[model samples]
Target: MTKPHRHASHPKLVARLKRAEGHLRSVVEMIEAERPCLEVATQLQAVESAIRNAKQALIHDHLDHCLDADSSEHDRAELKAITRFL
Candidate 1:
């Protein structure tokens, strides 16, 4: 199988991760400040959703670019690896 390389969507994926990181930091601060449990939970949920969306975007880009460059046999193996994330 070919090694994975960065694709056009990589920058967007990085941005999403950075946003999630920032949100996570905020959640930590909220906790430190003794914020309400519900408020902290809401922010945590946003972080989780951001991470999930980033993962989906990465998988979509990988399938689009990597699969197109590889053989059918390799594609099947790559697809199996990808499905494990889903």
Candidate 2:
């Protein structure tokens, strides 16, 4: 197998993941503070969406760079592994 190349968008994807982590921490803080259920739920939803978006971006980058570097057989196996996250 060829060495997997890093995607150009890797930094952006990492930034997004960091932002999602911060958002998750905020949600934990909100729960500890005993904030209203509605407010807490809303923040949780935002965190979830951010994480999902980050996952999608990472998957896109993987498909774009990693898959391009692989043979058809390897790509099929890699794609199966990647789709498991979805």
**lDDT winner:** 1
lDDT by residue (tens digit), candidate 2, 12-37 = 98898899899899999999999999
Best by TM-score: 1
Candidate 1 local Cα displacement, residue 58, angstroms: 0.2
Name the lDDT of candidate 1: 0.86
Task: List candidate 2 stretches off by more than 4 Å.
Answer: 1-5, 69-72
Model 2: pairs clashing at backbone N, Cα or C within 3 Å: none
Clashing pairs in model 1? none
Listed in order, each prediction's TM-score against the native is 0.87, 0.83
Q: Write the per-residue lDDT of candidate 1 for residues 26-54, one digit (tens) a residue.
A: 99999999999999999999999999989
The lDDT, on a scale of 0 to 1, for candidate 2 is 0.83
